[model samples]
Target: MKFGVVVFPGSNCDQDMHDALQNDLNKEVQMLWHKDKDLSNFTTDDCIVLPGGFSYGDYLRCGAIARFSPMMQSVIEFANKGGKVLGVCNGFQILCESHLLPGVLMMNAHRQFVCKNAFIKSADGTPLKIPVAHGDGRFQADEKLLDELQVNNQIIYTYCDKNGNITPEANPNGAARNIAGIRNKAGNVFGMMPHPERATSSLLGNVDGVEVFKFLGLN
Candidate 1:
């Protein structure tokens, strides 16, 4: 399926995601502007990606302002209709703000911006080394919601070490349960802090992110 990468006012990773999908994965991709509300060209078989960046200069909150964009309205409608939506970093924040995903992305435990490579593992113990860059990347949710997520198998990825051990020390931003990524109840929408697109290219010395895309049925 083709992929569409949304570009917001301050988006910096839009091209990165496009390159990963178009060049590395050999998939068709389109750059969608935040002001454009039409998604008629894309179908349920396609995917819409919200790349990492400081949307609207992170004003009001990380993604608070960007959620009301005309394009986001269409995105929300698309997601509700079972369209595949993937949000990374700030994009993840937007999904939460839009209520497309549960929980909120809070500031880091140390209240500082973090940018580095972190290890994360899937439910089956598949590990990947992906990069995370954000200030408010910590994910928090209510106990009830957390339990529901775990029960539904919606918690797709969690922080871990190189050897695939889950520990507090391995948690980068103090996300609750070390949650690095999660999917909606229907599994059509996904939100994650770690940047799998950044790790997809072999030239970067790590292709573990390819496994992530494969798991998402992108390959």
Candidate 2:
């Protein structure tokens, strides 16, 4: 399936996502600009990616301004119609800001921007090592909502040790329950703070993140 990488003015990782899809996965890709409103070329079978970056220079709040861009309206509509949407890092913030995903990404408990490789585990216990770079990567939500996400199995990834043990010490961002990623109830929309796109190539440190895209049918 084709992948569309949305590009906002301050987005720095759009090319990373594009290259990962086009070169590594050999999939058709499109660069969707923030000002553009049309997403007609994409369908339910395709994937729309909101790449990582400090959109609008992270002003107001992370993803707050970018959420109102013209193209987001189409992105939201596409997701509502069963299309797949993936948001990475700041993209994740945008999804939360847009209410496409439950919970907010608060500042790190350490009160500092963190940049490092983090180990996380999928719900199925798949181990992944991905890079995370953000100040507002902590996840927060009400206890009831967290329970609902857990009951619905919407939690996609959680911080874990190298051996796949889930523990608070492995949580880099102090996210609620050490959550690293999550999907919507329908499982069409996904969001994560880690930079899977940055870890997809073996030329980088590791290729473990490729499993995530493969899980999404990247082959």
Q: RMSD for all candidates, in order, please.
A: 0.7, 1.0
Q: Model-by-model lDDT, in order?
A: 0.94, 0.91
Worst 10 residues of 1 by lDDT: 210-219
Q: Write the per-residue lDDT of candidate 2 for residues 1-219, one digit (tens) a residue.
A: 888999998999999999988888788999999999999898899999999999999999999999999999999999999999999999999999999998999999999999999899877866788899999999999999999999999998999989889998999989999999999999899999998888878788688778878765544
For candidate 2, the per-residue lDDT at 202 reads 77
Enumerate residue pairs that collide in model 2.
none
Name the TM-score of candidate 2.
Answer: 0.97
lDDT measured at residue 6 in model 1 versus the true structure, 0 to 100:
95
Q: What's each prediction's clash count?
A: 0, 0
Assess the local accuracy of residue 219 in candidate 2 as a C-alpha lDDT between 0 and 100.
Answer: 47
Model 1, span 52-113: residue lDDT tens: 99999999988999999999999999999999999999999999999999999999998999
Q: Which stretches of candidate 1 lie over 4 Å from their true place?
A: none
